[model samples]
Target chain A: MKRDLFIIMFISSILIFPMTVEEIFDKVDENMVYKNMKFTARMNILEYNENRELSMDIFMRDENNILIEILASSSGHTNRFMKKNDQMWLYIPNAGKAIRIKGHMLKEGFMGSDFSYEDMSENRKTNDLYNMELLSKDTLYIIKLTAKSSDAPYKMKMVYIKKDIFIPIREEIYSSSERLLKELIINEYKKIGEKYIPINILMYDKLKQNSRTEIVYEDIKMNAGIDDKYFQKSYFER
Target chain B: MKKIFLFLIIIPYIIFALRFSGEYNYNYYYYQSLNAYGENRVILNMNADKGIASFHLQGLGQFYIGGPKYIIPYPDNIPNYVIDNLPSYYQLSNSMKINTAYLSIYYLGFNLKFGKFPMKWGISQTYAPADIFSSTSPMDYSYIEEGILGFLGMYSFGDNTISFIYQDHTDYEQTKQGLLFENINNYFTASLFSAHFFNTRRIFNGFVFRTNTVEYLLSGFNIITDYWGPGIWIEIDYFADVEYWIQDSIADYSHYFLIAGVDYTFNDLLYTSLEYIYYSEGKTDGFTYNDILRRYLNDNFLISKHYLIPIIGINQGETISGEFAAMINANDLSSMIMTSLIYQPREYLSMDLNSSFVIGNLGKDFYGLPPIYTFQLKFYY
Candidate 1:
């Protein structure tokens, strides 16, 4: 009994210094936010012994703009998804039309993948819209975040952040009623310039059986000096 | 022809950024107590994108096999009086067409396009009153994208755009000019448009017998938004100065079309929506002369006053999805329910099956034709 008590006290002494939620999230922002980023990725979706693959080149500028150009598909037709200023537009090359999507539609799976448009959208500055609390401190900083804004993608999120690197290694997303919706794990990261970024990720929908999506980034470039013209509709048509 | 041939040969050498794509689609339609048909369609497209300019050329080839042919020979036995009116086998034909050929230029703040291209604009899936250019045939919806010859120009400023279009109908008197303004934002997409046709024709007994040289006006507004939890859309269109030209007498009047709807999605996997539509050109009790004439000229979906549509769609996995819909004519309680399924085993191959049930009297004004069941196989390269 005395040995057990001593072990507990020893662990407590090591935890005398603790990190604040604000400080941790500020570090997170540093690792996540960027001026311009370009990445080429391949997504593999597996369900019921069947697999589907999609190849895309994603470009992002600032917090509100992202363009996903689907490079390869079965029909060899080019399609695009662009998010600018809280609005999403889907461009079909065959139709020559850009259809504006809605909020709930953003929550649907993108191209039959496990990733939602909400998940593909650039979500930055976690400290701004979420009430953050550090849940525990050990090998990792366990944190809980409840959304403070109505337009937040998820009602609540639990983050498992790696130490020193300030990058989240895993996350559990929950709905408003506290139901677990999806679980995401970052499998690998690459040290690019001064920051560490996730390069391989896996997401599973808790509501489905034997459903999984794996996203592997083939190439990633940070602060690549991407032009604003590439984010416009005319440029997308070209 | 010589110039086009020269351009096609030389341009391929000059432009290294050219892409070629084609599709072959075969659809078989069968119905009871009606003629069965099979159609084979092939489309080939060549596209070039260089700097601020782009070009697209599409060629289509279609073959109608066993035209108006049926597997079941009429009836086993019929009275001589009924046998005299039996249907005859129709001859099959084949044709090739240049579906679309357009050149688009984007420079500074202006977007310019000239040639023959399909005009696609609408909000709702089934009934979009603002889509006055070309409409889709829901029953036989294969290779049905129609393009008109036109020149279009548009200028954009921030969140708003203004466009002008001029469509040619082989002569100056049959030309059409239009202008449109739109503002797209995070919450709502709204547009106001107007088109004026220099001349239109009159249809009688399923044929456009003569042309009327009177100006006609078509105008509309469309607004779509995501309101709180569900998506809501509303569209309104007006037709003015329509000339009937019956018995060498001119009958002029106006008509209106309206549509409003809302949709909700469940867990991002299931989609559901309900819609209500109103057509002013139709009668509440029955179809009018204006309604029948509009149906002959334009391939309008509904001919009666009120309609309600409920649709549900589900995507279970990466490769499979299905949609079921019911369009009901509120005036007579007649309805059509349809379901379509698509399966893609590979990126280059797909098979589709669609079946529908029509529940109404055989003499209804619209959607009274025998329902067509379709099985199609498509290949792409």
Candidate 2:
């Protein structure tokens, strides 16, 4: 009677409910996006066997407002970039006024790295930009995301999220023309409070051979209260 | 004076910042006239921040070496008296300058700044008519500025800001004052400014040189926007009182300068811009040596009525880049064409190769000068 009871209990556990795409994505968004956050990061652009490094501090308010202050640069002088809603501006130090930048400029490599300005600005939820569906699930859940808006940065993306952690481990990005443009591989996840954050990321430009960028995220603080003034136009002008 | 600047730069690096940071740059030029020269600059920088207050400083020591050992003889047709009076073509020794030394303090939801800093009042890229505080060089993409010494006070509310600036100059007759108002909207930024300028004039009194101060009153408006597909900007400045010497050409006439430009970048590969400028102080008839001398003294270097500037660039981001730009004087059909190539191999090292050529007749604008080739290297620590 004990052996029959054990077999029935094990079979009942195997027949549990599978997570739908919406449920899985909602979890991913909860673990990833935050209303207010701050982080320090470094980027290494490998070229001709030489590593060009840049360090910056990023502040985000919601998903639409982002400001990046370059603390150290290979080019010497300090500069800043602010993205408010759909508009962007590069605030060159000492030049006084901020110059408005356009959307096409977003595709440019950021500080000569494989990460474009578009990539740095992608702190939004995938549900808003893409229509996601579950492709397959084994050790990892392979999800397919198709662009919902024509203005989306990428045409399609394939995100592979860990089943247990619900954090993305790899992403294949496609260009607007449906070309395989970039591949991002994430590693070294750290548990901070109730969330798992990826600290190490490497991106490769598929069109260019031996072109890659390494990014390290550090000192991340989530739900941090920052002065609302920092997101205002006067903050940059000052 | 040099000691004062040195003391100012060093004291801050010691008190405000523990780390001493700077840059060293060397530039060499060889003109088609077979003359060669070089310039060396050592820049020191410091930054310190605690709470709502911050201190920032940058100082430069530049040494110009080589070039024509003596002044070249002017052509017979040109005025040769001034050339005869001058001893040398250039200054061979180095000079020290304080580029920026400002202390920014925040209190009571207001902003205050003291000391020397760059006053960016113009929205135009290549030519800024509204930027009356400093001159912008056409070839300098870095926007190297000689910031003015002043006191700035700012107050911001909502999406608008109002600022008042005052500068006292020992060489000027009266203090310089400016009031600026700026508003930022969803798609565009607009600003209106009014200012009073006092400049110095050095006149020879046979036995000695005397300093005389002149005045020019100005008001301007500018806008920068990206709502359109391309970046577009416009700047306009109207002078109620022109400089004393410039009044001879347009006596008691209201002078106006207008500049408009559009720029676009295609991904990481290409960048392009075009600008049109119109200045009422410029002579539509022609220019003489006396006119050129007066223009040089007043810093009104653009001597033509209408101008056009077009630039094209190709880049692999900041790794490797090349640009070709031209400044055309519509009145004379003469132009200056400049091209540059830049390469940055490592994080702290960069090299630039540049060249410029002028096209015109002997007496036309931008004429009789040889093409200049330059190579520059910079190191940052």
lDDT of 2 by residue, B1-381 (tens): 345445545665666643346889998877666577778888877666556766677778877777623233232254445545434353356679778877667764477777776676676666666666675756332335776777788877766888898875665655678899987777787899998886565443333435555567889898877776677888888877555555564435458889898888765468888899998978764555544444434445577888999999887745688989988988888888999999986556899999988887755655645677889899877
Extract clashing residue pairs from model 1. A74-B347
lDDT of 1: 0.73
What is the lDDT, from 0 to 100, of the residue B377 in candidate 1?
Answer: 92
lDDT of 2 at A191: 85
Two-chain DockQ for model 1: 0.26
C-alpha-based local distance difference test score of model 2: 0.73
Which predicted model would earn the best DockQ? 2
- Give Cα-based local distance difference scores for all models: 0.73, 0.73
Per-residue alpha-carbon lDDT of model 2 for A1-238, expressed as tens digits?
Answer: 9999998887786567567888898889877775688889988888657677788888988777888887776555566788776677787545555766664468767766888788887778878889988989988999999999655678889999998889999999986677888899997778888888888899988876677898899789887775556656556655
